[model samples]
Target: MTDSGIPVVFIHGLWLHASSWAPWLELFRENGYQPLAPGWPGIPDTVELARADPESIADKGIDDVTRHYAAVIDTLPRKPIIIGHSFGGMIAEKLLGENEGVAAIAIDAAQIKGVLPVPLSSLRATLPVFKNPANRHRAVSLTAEEFRYSFGNAVSPEESDELHRQWTIPAPGKPLFEAATANFSPHSPAAVHTENEERGPLLLIMGGQDHTVPEVITKSTLKQYRGSSAVTDLVEFPDRGHSLTVDSGWRAVADACLDWLRKQNL
Candidate 1:
C-alpha cells in the first residue's frame, strides 16, 4: 500500500498472470495512480515458474479464490479502484458486492450469475476444456489461429501471434466450468453484481467484436446493473475481441479508463 489512500488494483484473469497489466501500469502510474496486481493462491511469482508447473494451480475454487482477494483488500487502508479482465472482472464484482467502497471496471468480464444469455462464441472459447477433465491442472497454450479467433480477431495477424506468445496460458478448467454452469448453482458466481446494489462506480467495457462476452451478454449486464445506485458506465471499442486489454491498441482502451478515472477523481 502506498501513502496514497486507495490505489488501483489490477486483477488478471485466468491463464495469464498479473504481469499482463504491465503496459497499463505505466499509464496508470503516470496519472498519479498506484497499480497493484496480485496472483491467484499458489500461483507462481513469475510467469516462467507458472508455465513450468501448471499442476500447482489445481485446487482453487470460486469461494477460495474470492476469499484470497478479499484478504488482500483487507490489508489495504482504503477501498481500491478494481480493474479486472475476464474472470478477474467477475471476481472484482464479487469482491465489491460483499464489501463496499470499491470502484470497478470490468473489461470483457466473463459471464456471472444474472448476466445470462451465453453465446456460442463463449462456449467455443471454452471448447478446449471440454476435451478432458484432467486438464484442469495442466497448463494449456492456445494455437496462433485459436488465439486469433478467440481473443485477437480485431488485431493484425502478426500482432495476434505475438499476443498469444506473450500471454495466453492454460487456465484452470474449474473456473470456466463454474462460470458456464453458474445459473444452475445454488450459489451462482455471476450473482455477485446483481445481488449488490451499493456497488460503486461500475464500468463495463465490451469489445464490439468480442465473441466470448458478446454485445448481447454485456447488454444483459448493463440492464441488471441499471438498478443499482452505482454510477454505471459503458464503453464499446469496435474491432476488438476478448484480448482488448493486451492487443496492440490496448493503450487506447487504457486511455479511456484513465479519462474516466480523472472524471471520477480516482
Candidate 2:
C-alpha cells in the first residue's frame, strides 16, 4: 500500500493497553496525522478482559514486545513518528536505534541499559513488582494504593481512584527483571543503541513528580544519548506524575508533543 499520510504510532507502557492512546489518537487525527497504537502481543481487547486474565501477560520479555511493535511499524508505507511511555518508550528508543522510525518521543521512559541512576521513589514505585523474585515470571497487578503512589500521586484522589479502576491492568514481570538486572547481563534486552548516527531526532518528556520513572531516570537516559549526532531534547512538567499521559492535564502534554513535531517539520 502506498503511504497515505504522516503515520504516527503511539506505544503505551505497562499496566495499560493500547486503548489508553484513544484520546491522543483523536487529537492527532484531527491534526491531519494518521495515528496507530498497537498493544503488546496477546494483550486483551478490553480493560475488563485484561484485568480478568492478568496472568496472560506473564513471561513476556522485552524482545517479544519490541518485535511485535517493530513488525507493526514495518507494515507502514514510510517510517513513522513514534511516541511511547514508560516501558513502551524504551521500546520506541530500541526501534529508533534500528532506524525503524522517522522521529521519536519517549515519555517518562523506563530505564534502559547504561542508565545507572536509581532514585528512592523509583525503587519504591517498582518494589511492588520487583521486591519479590517470584514476580519475575508472573504477571503483577498493582493495588489502588500502589497505583496512587506510582502513577497518580500528583492528581486528585478521585482521579487516582478512577484511573486505577479503569486503566490499570496486570503487567508482565520479565521486562522489569530484565531492566533491573541490565547492568549485570551482557545480553540484556534492556540495552539500546544510543550512539547510532542514523537514529532520527528524538525527544524525552518527563513528569517531575513521577515516582516510577523520575527526572533522574529520564535524565540518565538522555545522558546516554550525549554522543549521538541526532537531535535529542528533554522537557519536564513540574506538576505532573507518571500518569501525565492519562491525567486531566494530558492535553497539555499532547500540545507539547504536537509543538515538538511541528518544530521538527514532521
Candidate 3:
C-alpha cells in the first residue's frame, strides 16, 4: 500500500462520515493529489446504516478518534496534507500539533482547550448533546430541525433537507462532553499544542454564518498560536455557514483551500 504522490487526508466532522467526502476526493484526484478519507472508527458505511445503529461509536472520545486518524497517517509513506471540517478540523489541528502532517487546513474547527470565547450560538449548536448528562456516555442523533440549526441555516430549506438526508448520521457524545470540559479536565484530549515548534503550516478556515464554530471561536483559536513559530493563517467566508464543506458553494471553499496549499508549496 505504498503511495508516491502527495497524499491528502480528508477528515469529516460530526453528523457525517467519510463517505461525505466523495466530492472532495474526486476534486483532489483531478488535480493529481492522492486523497484518502478514513471514517471514524466503528462508523457505518452509510448514513442509513449509521442512523439505524448509533451505538457503534457510542462513548468514543477525542483521544480515541485522534489515535485512529494518527494510525492511518502512520501508514502513509509521506506525511499528508490534512484537511478537515468541524470536529474533523479539530482533529487536523491535533495531528499538526503532534507533528504528524506536512500541512493542515481546518474548516470551522471546534474550539480547543485554550480557546476561551464560547459564543451563544456555539453553545446552542452543541446543546443537543451537552444539555443532557446522559449523552456523555451514549451516542446522539440529530433531528432534521437540529441539523438545520447547527449546520444548514445558511442554505435553502430544500437544500437543507437534501443535505440532511445525504449526510446526517449519529455521532458519539463523549467527544462533545470532553470538549465542553476540556479546560477543566486534567487530561483533556481536546487540549492542543499551539506552541509546538515542530508543528507544520496550518490554516484555519471560518464560515461567518456558521452557528456551530463561528468567526469569534475560530479567531480565538487562531490567537492561541500567535506566539508559535509555525506558519498559521485564517481565512473567512462571510456568507457561508457550517455546511460550507458540502454546500452548493463548496467549490469556492475548496478552491480557496487549493490556493492556500499551493502558496505553502505543500
Cα lDDT tens digits for candidate 1, 31-122: 77777888887788777877777777765667667888888877777888888888888887777777644688888887777667978887
TM-score of each: 0.93, 0.98, 0.97
Task: State the lDDT of candidate 3 residue by residue for 1-266, as single tens digits.
Answer: 34757899999988887888888898988887899999898898877788888999898888899999999998988899999999999999999999999999999998899888888998899899988899988888888899899999999988988898889888988888888889898779998889998888999999999999989989999999987988999999999999999989899999999999989986
Q: Between candidates 1 and 3, which one is better according to TM-score?
A: 3
Specify the poorest-scoring 10-residue window by lDDT in model 2.
Answer: 1-10
- Best candidate (score: lDDT): 2
Give me the runs in candidate 3 sitting further than 4 Å from their true place. none
Q: Point out the higher-scoring one by lDDT: 1 or 3.
A: 3
